[model samples]
Target: MSLRLHTLVHACAVVLAAGCLGATLWNGIAERGIALAFGVLVAVGELTRHNGPRVRQTAPLAAAGALAYALLGEAGGRPTHHDAAQIVTVVLAGSLLGSVPHVGRGPGPARDHLARRTLTVGFVAVCFQPLYARGTFDDWGGSAHALLLLALLSLSTLCDAVLAAALAHSRTGWPFPPVLRDELRALPGIGAAVVATGAVMALGVAVVGLWALPLLSVPLLLAQLSYRRYAAVRATYRQTITSLARATEIAGCTPAGHARRVAELSQSVGRDLGLTEPELTVLEYAALMHDIGQLSLVDPVPVGATAALPVPEQRRIALLGGAVVRQTGVDPRVAGIVERQADPHREQPLAARIVRVVNAYDEKSRTGGPGGPLTALEELRLGAGEYAPQVVESLARVLSRETRERDGLTRPGAG
Candidate 1:
């Protein structure tokens, strides 16, 4: 199903792009100067785009330029004549041309990104160009024009977000609602800037002509640069946390890669349980350092199997981990989760409950084991009275899917 859906997404984009290119060839070109200007703006945007892991919108400037072109009605008080097909063609050309240099140097836009970009621009152009060409928006002058552009861009932005989430879900088999929730959560940030800049560029072009393109683009460029810096800072912070999490292993208090395995499994379960993005982050950080407290232990629990230790010892280690987390200036919630992972399920927050269950599962399956994964899971289930029943179930489901995926019993992108 995901395979077909994934193909359908790309197929739709290919069809739209083909139609636009064919139409443009038949219709020749209109307002070549304007098209070239916006095309260059888009290409420049792509060249300067941020490629950070956490970046939601990588090419904000390209998006704004294309959207502005879609909503364009007049330039320098003269009615511009470019249509939907021309708008899509120009943007597509710009995207391809801009990606050329990045071919061997770095990662270019993926198939999904291009598909999303093409479809989004096509959507905006289809809605606006025909309406303006028909003179339906003739009376929409001044504030009416600005408001209409804003409304159109807002709707287009929402559609792009939905498409992005849908494509991601199809390609990765992640649950849709959580992915959609994250996209919607980003709407107020770079999404807003994209919409506002697109609309403002359209308005600016109408009054001040094509010269408005470069001048109106300054704010978004600055915002993009600032966001890149922020992404760098965030990446550095996460690296620092990861290095810290490895301390137990470095000191031989825990098995090599134990923290990483637990963190990965915990995050997978957290997503399966429908934790939001920020909640998942806290869960991951807490899971990675869940064993940091073992560094404080006088003697490491054999194989770092804190899960087999007495409750008091586990609690002591958890408290010590929390203290260490606090001293590192991490998020307070992360510290809290680390601190409370040893508490009873009902008394603990969901993140803490997740860490506790997944940690035990990893320890059991890896070392304190006989039947391996199945045996470890059985043990965790029997002790669900201590672990949250819901979290344990989520862990089981995540592990089951992972097992099938690993064994190739399930198809790629099958959840």
Candidate 2:
């Protein structure tokens, strides 16, 4: 399922639990009803086809269910201390489950980082809640006590999610699944949630008594500042990458242009693989500069010799390409791609994979010396599994169209 849907479902669960807990306390509904409902929901989710990782990934939402059960038990006339302890236990359990790791295309590193934050916050809640209450809630009304606890837990969760997401973004350059980045980029919503929850709770406790606000606010503010600084750095890096990519296009403007065709064709393949705009920019620069290392390739044969140089020349080209990218301050992830292209046997990075595919086609098309387009196709087929499959397919399509156009066998737009 989409990450948006997943997060929305969790948010809904929190709200619904709050409403049910409120109703049970005020109207004296059997607290068992809320407990049963939550139990059924958890059981259904567990028995569903989802794997362990997804269930664990979403365990934070289960805390809402836990809160509801505790509130209901107290409202149904159970002892206050008993239900509060249950609430603390269940919330901690839920937080622990969230800390369990999951595997997927969604950024696992970022998720693990967030999970650690949640666990830390959960621990704080378990340790501090009892001290904060100091047995004062034993005789308090069930409704008021439940509201206070719910507000505190929600605020704590918000703090963890906000801080974790910001730190993860700085480290991973985006949140897991991309949608999370968009959500995190809208961090004012998190701030509003904290402020609103605190404001509502302040009606009972003095605004000054909400010590969690000021304590958590400092970290949240720092996270926001860090996120902004990272964004600024990324923006400047993006401009440099774009300028370099455009510079490659200007290097040679003949009919068989250098970087533009490679970039356009590389982008077409990258699009097929669901890469983002920023990823495309990185791919373009990497592709355009793939041959920068070739500038260092020296002819093994003397000027009088007509024989082509050996594989060592290709190795030299790849090494030079890596040097150029490193000099430009490209991220290690991108630089690794340029460097690995030297050894075709090595796993090529996605960016380099695309560049290599198009570069081969362009070389064959321009040289047109021996096997022509067929020679290029054969070379790609030989390295099929070594290259990204989608990139190879894009090269084939581009070549077929170019050939058909040349032979008057197809129109410009014909595929």
Candidate 3:
């Protein structure tokens, strides 16, 4: 089926299910209306969610989940203590239904992804119950209550980030600090939208009661659209860089697909070494452009010739490339990485270190100068000072995993 038609049909189904569920569960228009709004927001979030560069998918439902919990907390007939079962039921159902579009992609991964989201929302609900029972915001005016709600929502977000970072580290062998750093960095971009959505939901509940909840959909949907646009722009930027990178390869300055392969390998090593997504991004871009300086030479470095260059010549190429990249208004950090690729032993940024090792490995592997992947890895290991021991080891792990996957061999702990 066409994607648009499928999306439309799926949305209609979700809306219908939400309306029926809300109507069956709550007699009041306010309660049912809020439930419907929550359902739609969840569906929109699911449909629009984007996969990030580092294999992490943003959880777009946090704001919607907060709104739903707030609505339940403020409903007129609710008791002092909220019902855990009801919160779980509403959240799990909405999340599961919303995730239907993703199920076919990979059943296990999709289910795991949905479960994590459900648990996060459920945890937020549990956390809010005490505040709800106390009617913490009831006495406060709209502005005052909204501030309190924002504070509570921020706390919940922090908890979620921490939990997610921990899970990523455990599951993917990613390091804790970098994962946490990335999560924290992400907050300012999306957090404002989430805070606004929660505030609107709270205000709506305060003013018009449950009826105001459906109106919350407007802002929530806008936020989702904004995220979608941002993701598209990011994808475009990556593609543009990729295209530029290919230019060097086409010019015979590097081997075919050399930049892309280096980028992939560098990114893998960066991830295993616990670099933040931003760091990994810079690393990948630097790797892709590492040979760009060769374009300046009357006789460009031959494909796979970089590994054979003298140290001074290599440094000269890197410096020229760094200068060229700097002219393009790219991140100075990225330029620094390209410049430092020639001096792998120097104390440089973690990302630069990653590029150095992976770039060298790709060059060696391409030429098959000494041996193949195994020989390349040994050369990197021998230059432990030039390449960080951890980075070399990370590269080794990356290669091992790739080999196993290619050979269709299951590692001991792999599922």
Candidate 4:
């Protein structure tokens, strides 16, 4: 079957399943209608969701908000099973239909999507199961009830981080520690959103009872739109920096695409080393602009050359480049990485070490200072005291993976 037709069929199946589940859980037509309305909102949010940072996924935030509302209502002595079932149905159906646009993209992405949503709803179920048995939120005082809800939300977030990290590690073969670290770094932001939504639901229930639940969607949808706009702005900013980096090559100060190549390599190595998404982002920007100081020198270093420079000259380049970056009000972390690119490993951040190693490899490979990539890697390995061993190994692995992928693509009839 064609991909579009297949996607339609899948979406229809999901819709039917959701309808059946909702009907079974809630006998009232009005209750079923409300559940389906939330489902549609979640599906729309998923469809409109933008790609988030590497360590964080934002598409599920709206569904999470919806779930929080449902849970809060359940905590108020409403039917627990009905609430749980409604949430699962909405999340599952919304996720399936939201993914219709991406059908045929690949099995890997599809699996990741399924893994994320399944773990998400599963965690919700686990959190609510105890409340279902207890059957009353009024047994606890208001303060205790609020604290309990917060605890449940926090536990859910932790489970999400662990599961997401595991999935990422499996896919990329990255070490679990670093992957886990990345996810932990992203939790505060996502956790805040989920908690804020729960707070709103609490307020609604306090004021107007269960009927006020659906009204919570107004603010949640607005939050989603705001997040989308913020993501778009960040993307545009990245592209602008990239374009400026390329201008240096156009001016004959660097090899064509050198900045982009180093940035890409640095990101891969940084990820493997367990840098957070924000840190990786700064590393990439620093890598791209690492040679910006060369523009100020009358005798610029030759294209595809940095290792050949004297120590003092190299430090001068780093200081100057850092100053230029700082003037733009970019993150202080990015400025710090650029400034310490020439520093010893023990004195520098992991990001700095990554940029330094990848930058050296690019220069050596392009200028033929060494025999090739392998020789350059060996040279870096010999200087272990000055570089982190793990970072060097990560660079090697990245290069090897790239080579393998290139070979696979170029083989006859590969496509």
Candidate 5:
């Protein structure tokens, strides 16, 4: 199924390339100087692509460059003559050329990246190229023209976000709303930079010619550096929390990998419950450190099965964990969830309820035997007074889906 989807995107690009390349060839490449400039801009952008960490958009410069070409109206007091097809051809050619050096690094994901870039640039060109060529914006002054370009870029941004989110949802099987919500939330930062860069390039070039590319790129470059720093700090912070979570294991207060299992399962359950990306992060942190309080106990619970402990004891440990989390400087929200996890379901927030349900599920499942998953799920359902029914049902569905996926993979002809 994944292969088929990639094939479809590739096939669509093939059709788009064919039509655009054919038209560009027929048109004999109007404004060769301008085309060459933007092409090189995009290539340079791609050449500097960051691979350090996962991000919504890896090559903001390339995207802004391509978009600038799509929205370009005039170069140094002279208007452009290329059509939308020519714009796509130029951008695609530049991207393929730029990617050649990275080919040895396994450029498989490049296909998807190129697909997104191609579609977005082509959309803007189709909308703006013909209109600009026909004098649609000729009467509009510089201010109006800039505003128009920005508005068009905003629409293009929305379409790109939708495409990215849909592709992510298909590939990961995560719920679409939260995936899209994450994509949209990520947009206002670098996404805005890309939009602004594209618009600025187009508008500035209309007056000052190609020189604007270098002059206008400084702020965007600063923004990119700032974003990279922010990503690094976040990675470091999460690592700190993960290391903290592992302390309980180091002290022999819990089974090996118990915190990790709880974190992963709780996150999956949180996604199934339609929590946004940020909400999921808090849930994950709380789950990882949920057992940290066990370290405070003079003697750990047998096998570290807190779910099987008495409620009052569980509450005491939860409070201790929350206190530890607070002192360690993790998000206070995470601490709140940990502190509230032992509360009755009705009294707990949604994240606390989810953590409580999934933590209990993990503990019960591990001890239930070969039929552990089913038995644990049944046990969770039976303890209806303590567990949130919605969360338990959501966990059951997630487990059931995972079981099906696992079974299918183990069957013959599975990849």
Candidate 6:
């Protein structure tokens, strides 16, 4: 069904529950409102977090809000087998809707995490009615029901955590299930299904008290499940991207050590420029991956050719590099910057300029003997247009200080 149709059905269910349940609806509405409000708050917080730990702190709040709402209501509703059945329907409907957006998507670490989280949340929302049903009974069955509910909830959450971890792995590239992906894409409908199921549970409880709670829990749980899962998946995807970047640093003859000098120089420049942590992460990844396209260079040119390709050959090389980056399917502009690492003066942004300058320093430094390093004037002249003048000057000052401290600038043309 269309989103509008699902929404309308959900609205009708809420209205019916309110009319049928009276006082129960009054209490549950306020409680559900609080839960939803908390969900919104946590989502906003997760969006702004600077790190994983901060983002993770929001999930517990969502769980706490759910528990609080469930705990506020009293016991003694009717037998809610119908409520239990309705919850399963709502969960299945919601899962179908939530997975819709992901349909036909292929294997990817990011997509896998997203699918896993959605499935876990779907399971949790669907099992809500059973949990509440267990809550309503006063006997030993009630205890067993609560235990089962707890186990299901734990399993759902565990699945999400596992997916998050898996998505962060460098080697992972699991295909997302087409059916499940489509369900995730249609989450608004899935959310509506939860609401509808909640209304039914609320209605059952109004007629019978605590008995309807199992039904009520379904909607409450469904509303926030997707949001949390999305957050976790996003974190996982970032880690995977970082791993890919680091892999690029290690792809060539020098191993990942080739990027070490670039990173060090860039960090020095970053401190000089007062970059933030997020900016530094971006710089580090870009620097590490700057030479990635070189790995795809076929019939490998001699080492110095990076600086002296004929015009036609240069264009051909750049095109080859661009193609290799496109194969990874990351952002093209980012790929373009990496491809142009050997040509820093191509009107890049400041960070790209810094990266290119440091890259040049590392390439040149590798050629220099370990003994006394090149003279300041010699190094500056060698590195002039290829690196920023200020960066060259900074290296000059550092070298000058080191030479003075270690050897009293005794060498000819040194101080």
TM-score for each of the candidates: 0.94, 0.38, 0.78, 0.77, 0.92, 0.36
- Whole-model lDDT, model 3: 0.67
- What range of 10 consecutive residues in model 2 has the weakest lDDT sum? 47-56
Q: Best TM-score goes to which candidate?
A: 1
| lDDT string, candidate 6, 277-298, tens digits | 4555566656655655556665
lDDT of 5 at 183: 86
How many residue pairs clash (N, CA or C atoms closer than 3 angstroms) in each of the candidate models, in the order given?
0, 1, 0, 0, 0, 25
Best by lDDT: 1
Give candidates' CA RMSD values in order.
2.4, 14.9, 7.5, 6.2, 2.4, 18.8
lDDT (10s digit) by residue, model 1, range 1-415: 2445768989999999999999999999999999999999999998887775557899999999999999999999899999999999999999999888888697778888889889998998999989899999988777898889999999998998899888877755568899899999999999999999999999899899998999999999999989888888888899999999999999889889988999998988888877778888888889988889888888778888888888888899999999999999999999999889778899999999999998888888886456778888888889967888898888888877777567664566555
Error of 1 at 123 (Å): 1.1
**TM-score-sorted candidate list, best first:** 1, 5, 3, 4, 2, 6
Worst 10 contiguous positions by lDDT, candidate 5: 1-10
The pairs that clash in candidate 2 are 293-321
Clashes of 2: 1
lDDT of each: 0.89, 0.48, 0.67, 0.69, 0.87, 0.45
lDDT of 2 by residue, 1-415 (tens): 2344334434543554454345435654333433344444333322221222112222222333332333332222333233333333343333334433433323232334334333433344454345444764556554775566556555555555555444444432332444244334443543343333333332322222323223433443454345446656766776676566554334432223555676777876665554655677678767666655544435422321111334566566567668878888777666676676645544666777777777666665556676767876677777765555667766676566556446654555553
Please write out the lDDT profile of model 3 over residues 109-200, one tens digit for every residue. Answer: 24335445545555555566656666764676657766766776777667656766766665455678988889888777665567567666
- Supply candidate 3's per-residue lDDT for 64: 56
lDDT per residue as tens, model 4, 180-248: 887777767755676666656654554565565557656666766776777788889999888867867
RMSD over all Cα atoms, model 2: 14.9
**What is the model-wide C-alpha lDDT for candidate 5?**
0.87
